[model samples]
Target: MRIWVVLAASALGLAGASRVAAQRALGKLLFFEPALSVNGKRSCASCHRPEKAFTDHRGTPRALRFAGNLRRNSPTILNAAGQTSFFHDGRASSLDAVIEAVLTSPDEFGSSYAQAAQRLGSSAEYRQLFRRAFAAPVAANTINAALVAYLRAQTATASPYDRARAGGPALPATPAAGAALFAGAGGCAGCHGGPQFRDGQRHEVAAGQWVKTPTLRNVAVTMPYRADGGAATLAAVLTDGYHRPLPPRPLTAPEVEQLTAFLEALTDTTSADHRAPAALPRMRDLPGRAVGGQY
Candidate 1:
């Protein structure tokens, strides 16, 4: 029902690196502390709802405070720690850099390092945590670093698919079927290869498709799929294709069911404060790799 992510214990760097306990301690709190955002109301938790696999459950491309609509759909935070890079563009490299970009991005919080420093850097609890985590005073850089560390600490869920991979006992037949279909004929295992299920690359629809390919860990939440966010459910994106490749690539009814069953089986209800219904919502591809990588 619940599984925390495990880091390989490889050190990231000197101070405020990787998933070390000291950094994670502060990072966990920073993950929810809205003070870091331009608006105190929009914490990382705002979009990446802890209960909903760390993505906004709303179906459309949500707008930030005063900012215009963002380009890509909000990717999930679950199992993101294992990813090579973040976002549809694969722009940011290190987690800390990702936080810094989000902090200043016009469509996101829209705050600069100075603004974050002025706000969160002054808090007593945050200050103390900074001292403990990095042995340095709280600042915008460390603050962002701590937040990124916390995010990297949020790992993927382990389901029957995982257990089966590990030679575990009996699991649901449909999910098992779903898993096989996903990795085989469904072409899911193509981009969604590896234990974490992503090649960390981006691809648009082949001929006439819309949206980017999101991870399968928590497919139940995050409706209104697509890079443009035109569709509402996972079903819509799968059937409609969101416009990227040109026209929609409709899935056969049976294929749709199998894929849905497979993805739904990957859901984890424990991290969520409020659970997304155990219903399959919808589904993309794209290409790139870059700096300040996530996961």
Candidate 2:
């Protein structure tokens, strides 16, 4: 009788937890909303455009409106959820931390939590959504939770490589050789390995680069190779190993060919799924607290 009661209670707790999670969709909706930008125009999509493999469309080292040398090239959102930390500096630990940090970044959203929050709370739409998603509505913590859920939702659909190895086309000779070279001499797979192609580990590659080592998942579409735009093409990035103002790697010309082939294979090559998102959220600012809900 005691065991049965305990099991029933456990199931009830899980059911409540799921309901709370469902209410969290508000945060994800806000992520792509341009209203979050200080200019009332630049959304997360401004830098991490979904259509372009979730990166800056222009592929500029520094964004058009940003200050000189935008910290690092805006990274791809491809498989970012799998990343251990956010940014080339590995500064943020989770999606919420990064979202809040960027929302107040003078270079990015440049808005305060109180100001943004009030903007959100004032809206009937935001209020109702928050109430539905939260135990109540318009709380700072609740807002943050919503945004975190939104970011975590940004997932990449399976690519050709996913299909190929899962029982379709065999890796062509060049890419096969490249894969071996990557796991072997070229050491391409040293940092980029496994299905998603990134260990989510930062390496001291000690090359003229410093980044959290982005994934090769969609290398074909996410270009302007290198965080600082040191390499213009994948081939240059692979063989020359993306440069720094200082120096580059020791990769040779033949190595570039093999590596490029491997990277090219990382592209989906046939998926048209990068369409606009469904149900664009209504974004108004959030209210209460200062520093734009600094997390």
Candidate 3:
């Protein structure tokens, strides 16, 4: 009887796991589904390309939405789940809210939730996936939740620094020195201190503008730093942006190289690397649709 009970519990656990897997799969499809946009040419993945650490690496100052350019740099969605607030200004309180804003924004998808649902609902493949994942009809809430689940699943915590932190391997001397500086005189630790390396709070810096402190987890790949993408490199950001706001403890060229080396150690050579799912469905185009590119 005890064996039977254990088997039953295991079966139930497997079933729950299967459902979660289904939801994530559906969410991945939706994330790459450009049909959700008004012009059927833009999707979440369009701007947040999986290859570029989930950031657009076209060298534009801001992200290019279907409607227009965003006012700020395209922050990487890698390790974004650890963040409390969404966007550069910390405007969206939750990931769902961020999705809603992007969906309806003129510079983004430029489609209402109802329109997105209607479009996606037309696809029999999408409907079946939704039913299997949610056991319900397609709707905005489920769509948002699915995407959030997928994004949250995209955590990048397995860097060399992480391994070193867990005592698996020691970082090299240069990075080790930089790590000490980060926690000590550099004052970077004040905001980018904890695990995930973000304080989850907004701060006023650089001309009185309020910006959220971003995660330094994969800072190596998320270049063109700051909210405006004004700084071209990590060295520039460290010397100019980060240095200007604090007291006169300056970093030398060698120190900057060491700091950069430490930042590189934070890059996750594993899950943080982006690759489009092979099973993603092709999008149907809308004729005569004008896509916006500026925010």
lDDT scores for all predictions?
A: 0.58, 0.62, 0.74
Candidate 2 stretches greater than 4 Å from native:
1-25, 59-69, 205-209, 241-254, 269-273, 277-295
lDDT of 3: 0.74
What is candidate 3's lDDT per residue for 1-295, written digit by digit as tens? 1332343234336568776777777777777776677767677877677777887764443332433457788788888885668998999888878888988877777788899888777767778877777676778877886787688788888899889989889999999998987888778888888988889888887567889988998888877788877777898888886564573467778888888999999999487536666654332433332222112
Cα lDDT tens digits for candidate 1, 1-295: 0011112122334533432677766666666655555555565666676655566656434456635556666777766665556666676655655677777877777678787666655556556666666656666656755665666666655665666667876557766776777766666677777767677776756444422356767666655565555667665655663321332344577766766777777766565334322311110010121111111
**lDDT sort, best first:** 3, 2, 1
Q: What TM-score, computed on C-alpha atoms, does each candidate reach?
A: 0.75, 0.76, 0.87
Error of 1 at 33 (Å): 1.7
Q: Give the better candidate number (2 or 3) by TM-score.
A: 3
RMSD in Å for all candidates:
10.5, 7.2, 6.3
Off by over 4 Å in 1: 1-19, 66-68, 206-212, 242-251, 271-295
